[model samples]
Target: MIPPGPKAEKLAEEARTRMLNEVDERRDPHTNATVGQLLDRYMKTLDVGRSTHGMYAKYLEKHVRPFVGRLKAGALDGETLDSLYAELRRCRIHCTDRRGVDHRTPRPDECDERCRSHVCMGLSSTTIRHIHFILRGVYEKGVRWRWVARNPVFDVDAPRAAKPDPRPPTAAEAVRIVDAAWEDPDWACSYGSR
Candidate 1:
């Protein structure tokens, strides 16, 4: 209280602003709702076709709910979403450790030599992007409805689509294919070639 300077005034103003923001957030309803609840609410209000709605529910259940469902709708941030995306990229199945198991074997008696050890395959970038899309939609709705003040997903980046790696036939391969096709007179007639 004894400080008397421009800097002291600035510090006091910042403190007051921070306190006010905290109070506002505490009073927000979004802060009281979990991400899972938000997703459920969004799903219920969605107006897409039956199949599209089913697909959305499937994506949310398989990719999103287990990761951030328990988080507060208002508490999500770029860092939290980024971590979730990274985890999904590392393993689509969300493997806890290197422990191997044959997922095909429904029972111990059904175990066979064909059942191989578990392999971790990361989620496709496209699917992850879809998940991100669903999240963005949900959060945008929350912001529009005033349930949340901002959409945290707006700060996060969705995974980019993978580039196509095309492998055209080499010169020799093209020649061999032409020779093979020419050997079949029926193929020439089918193509209306003399």
Candidate 2:
């Protein structure tokens, strides 16, 4: 609903250009941009390896973007992020094929295991940590660009991944046990105890 004037014509032309272009530069760069908008900008500015960028993109697509996509970058609060992490910690991923087909097929033997419930497909703490890094990077950019006052990532704590405990090497210790089992005159001679 424009009043049909030179200003309206200029805005319409800009909108048309934005639609034709692959990049969405419709929003002004200096404004308090939305989380989704900033993510796109951050992704476009990545100078890392393709594989690394792909992984970051995957993390954004799979978790971070889906949750906070529409929220304004400046509007992100600690409580909202903490709540998102809580949900992510308990979230179960539905494994799918390249064709987007669900991988969970029900079998009689698997019924007892709740095969359809995806109990074992939950996102790991380490993966959630990765998502955190992606968000942190985006917000860091926001901070640098003066889009936001400061990064909100520092305000929340992500869950710690457990380190597996190391056990003594029983197989290597077995060789020592065998050596001790055969204490002989050769051992004494070797040490010049004869």
Candidate 3:
């Protein structure tokens, strides 16, 4: 029964296609999976250098997992992610504003009075950007897998990249360095301009 226009026909067809896709998505268990599960699955399939892979795993474990690990992938929104980032910025360890010993020893028996009290240190913007990178990739994969229709991360703003802050040696320190270099002919030879 009919819409005579081409545009009308196209719109009707798109609606029908979307309805069918929704039905299929409803039956897929991945649609209900949590972000943590998605991250774990993504890691298993990620292909990268050993060191990069290790760093990604470490970032996920230490940052993302502790906060929103239990949240459903489809349910996440930009606000939730923003909150997570804010908390991380406040304290990397998510400290309760209480003092605790920052233990260097794995075994408490090995711990001594020398262990210093923990200080809250927020992650740098660059490190936070790395976290954003990991989540963006993961959510993109989730979209492809139909776990989510859209990546929530697209709505969030990543922290700005940090600029390098360099400090040149003081004149006194530079003089000391020159003095030491000339003390040995071999050191002087090694200090030549490239």
The global C-alpha lDDT for each of the candidates, from Candidate 1 onward, is 0.85, 0.74, 0.87
Error of 1 at 50 (Å): 2.3
Selected candidate, larger TM-score, 1 vs 2: 1
What does candidate 1's lDDT look like per residue over 39-85, in tens digits?
99999999999998998999899778898989888888999999999
TM-score computed on alpha carbons, candidate 3: 0.72
- Give the top-scoring candidate (lDDT): 3
61-144 per-residue lDDT for model 3 (tens digits): 999998889999888899999998998788887888999877877576566777888999999898999999899999998888
Kindly indicate the candidate among 1 and 3 with the higher lDDT.
3
Clashing pairs in 3: none
Once fitted onto the true fold, the runs of candidate 2 whose alpha carbons sit more than 4 angstroms away are: 1-30, 94-115, 171-194
* lDDT (Cα, tens digit) per residue for candidate 2, span 10-73: 8888877765562353233346589998899999998999999999998888787777889988
Model 3, global lDDT: 0.87
